[model samples]
Target: MTITQKIKSLPLTFLLLFFTAVNIFGQKPNIVLIISDDHACQAISAYGSRLTQTPNIDRLAKEGAIFNNAYVTNSLCGPSRASILTGTYSNINGFKDNISYNFDFNQPSFVKALQAAGYQTAWIGKMHLGDSIPQGLDYYNILPGQGQYYNPDFIRSGNVQKRYTGYVTNIIEALSNEWLDHRDRQKPFCLIIGHKATHRVWMPDLEDLGSFDDKTFDLPHDFYDDYATRKAAAVQDMTIAKTMRMGHDLKMYDPADSATFEDNIKRMNADQKAKWFAYYAKIKKDLDAKRPEGRALTEWKYQRYLKDYLATAASMDRNIGKTLDYLDKNGLSKNTIVIYMSDQGFYMGEHGWFDKRFMYEESFRTPMVMRYPGVIKPGTAINDFIMNIDLAPTLIEAGKGQAPAPVQGRSFLPLLKNQHYTARDAMYYHYYENGEHSVSPHFGIRTKRYKLIRFYKRVESWELFDLQKDPHELHNIYDEPGSKPVIADLKAKLLKLITAYKDTEAAAIFARAI
Candidate 1:
């Protein structure tokens, strides 16, 4: 008999060979994950942006399956990215906020998992998981907590935090390209290209400042959401009127580079004042000359929003196009899976919000695109209820390997193959309150056409929406008698999901609601 047949008869040898085969096949995908920080899916032309032209990001969606219903388990930054990495929820991973906190590398993250499976793993750009990074990672180039637009400090290896002289955009790409060049060509790799663009205090590169100076954009219909619908929305720290800084945002300054000012600039000397005024003189003049009114003010915000935001996307997309070109040039596109996604979706003046913390559709629905030549059909749309946690399992499945245990997600490989596959009946969402900002702690469930949300530890509030009737989620119908049966059914399912996912708070709330 052949050694393979003899080994199949022998129990230990068969188990060993089976395990070896699983490891070999499971870690074979050359994954290229491109992630942007706080990037609004609405801002990208690929997702439906009329003003912003993001051809590269659009091309990613054009060449791959665009998932219309992908979401993050947690809404915040570190928490969401951690979930993606470990395929575990925030509570399980123990890293919830963006502040200083360590991601326990004990959990099998995709980086570590790929490393274990003999694949080269490298992470570049923003890895805000924690201070103490792990060993055995092939190469790491991470930005400190929230990196800057110009002249950013990056940690090459852990102890070496060096300030680079160039823009962060170019520097990160330089490192990524270098890593790609040095890596073994025969070995598969997993490269995570994370970006620090379009986050808070949106700053653009110098080259992109005058790109959209002449254009104006429109605002959403509900730019003014009356807080009467939800109590927590009433007491939030995020408002464009009060929250936006005037001096930083407006860019107002004196007219000329003179040695003195007209009793105005108090915080500087003659030379310094002259420099400041010279820097912002033109911008201030432009603003003073233009008087925007009514929808114009909203339009101004949209214009400012896009000009500043799309610059980041423009630079980022250019880098992405460069990588795509490299893949094509190197004949790697056929055997590679390329995915571009944000940590979570962001709001582009949707319902008068700037950031994404609400259970609203804008924040809940993320932009997801998958391009795998062997599996996914180009330009396909899958409405499957998938989460960030599912990414690891799906990649593992595509590699023809089993996912590790204790993950609260299912692979969407079947959906990629056949978009009509039915795997999940409902998707659950839970946002915890850490008080960095006053986002109400809430948990909910979203099915194909229905959504139910329950506010926690406060006023015992509930919201129900028939998405078919109201796609915008403008009205809250929690008290409607018509939805009692549906609410009950969903609540039961939510409770079961809580138990399965080990969401202690949701399980408690579910018990109380029952």
Candidate 2:
């Protein structure tokens, strides 16, 4: 071939290379979000937990990145979910708590953004926001309210209610795979798989029942916390000894005696009901024989709680493995981004508590592990402080689209890619519901070394903890000597964050305090 002939073919060669590059780098990636209820980091082995092994959840960290400082704007389930979707705080999003507030679907959401970008979206499992599906999602089959562990009822895409005859965790996993199999193959997709495991009334699958019966858990170091100077922690009702009931929570009561137990038993099929009753009958008999009193009774309750919770979590972990396997078998593993997280952290016998509400480190810091092949390097540990609100923008960016105008969280895509990024020095948290658990309404800021919290509404008091000195937050050194400067700095940062977030009510509280 002559020089002129070679020059004539150069244009076609360049065009071919351009198309290949677009296919390799410019294509949008699929997103898989697996969210669990009340899954504490302390119960997961990936976080160095002594309670249980969570290989499936840990796989995400092994393959991609594990975040050490991931937190939630609000630590309640519904509000955290709302913040994750809208990229805003509870005050801005208007879903402040589980009971009193309804999610405002009018706001911009990440799902809507993904839909606009020609991606199909579906949410299956526990979306406790409402009975009706939110506006942004293309399809859904969500559980109504806090879904049952056995034979749960799911509200489908057209408001059709159907009872699935299986464990809630397994049912959600099956539904997720079903959606994946039937999704529009031409377009990318985002699937949120919500599991109702490790929630209150921890009921494991029939096969998983008594799986942890032999393991004895040591009590948390601060299990007998006297609350000391922490006024808000003292008045609270969330406790393993008092708040957790034998009937409703532990399944150690006769069905006729407890309406919650009766209601739950009625939902299970005959075989499931029989297995559940048989397993608990042994526990009830053992309890009656021992008749544990005083500290013995409390210790028994703690053991039962941990065993049941860890057993329930076992089913969730197995189901997670199934979902990961589905992606692998379908050749979607490479182009798909898989994220495993909880709505918020829960107390696994931390500070003598079973629920999550306070802004302490245990409840405030949620677990988050994200796997994005080729983008996030394997075994990367990110120490940057990121809140749940950041999920919306990060997912939107992954779909190759922009977040909505109202979204507040800046995308953490740069951090995932190991690019130049600015890390947040402090993160803000607020809990609004003073209804359940008697936790006072509070807003606070957590820096790297110090945490400053102010409890208001029912109890107006300030508590400050030097996390470096007291990781468990046992000592409230708000009035300790030599702490004035530190308190002033934290307050300044907290006020700045409140103003930046446009939280007028918090600003008013700050002004009143000053």
State which candidate has the highest lDDT.
Answer: 2
Off by over 4 Å in 2: 1-24, 259-261
Positional deviation of residue 238's Cα in model 1 after best superposition, in angstroms: 1.9
What TM-score would every model get versus the actual structure?
Answer: 0.86, 0.95
How many steric overlaps does candidate 2 have? Answer: 0
Residue 102 alpha-carbon offset, candidate 1, angstroms: 2.7
lDDT (10s digit) by residue, model 2, range 430-472:
8999879899999999999999998899899999999999999
TM-score of 1: 0.86
Residue 226 local lDDT, model 2 = 93
Q: How accurate is candidate 1 locally (lDDT)?
A: 0.74
Q: Give per-residue CA lDDT, model 1, range 51-168, as digits (tens).
A: 6888888888889878878898878788888888878887777776666467887777766666766778788898778877655378888887877666678887656788765567
Range of the 10 consecutive residues with the lowest summed lDDT in candidate 1: 258-267
- Number of clashing residue pairs in every model? 0, 0
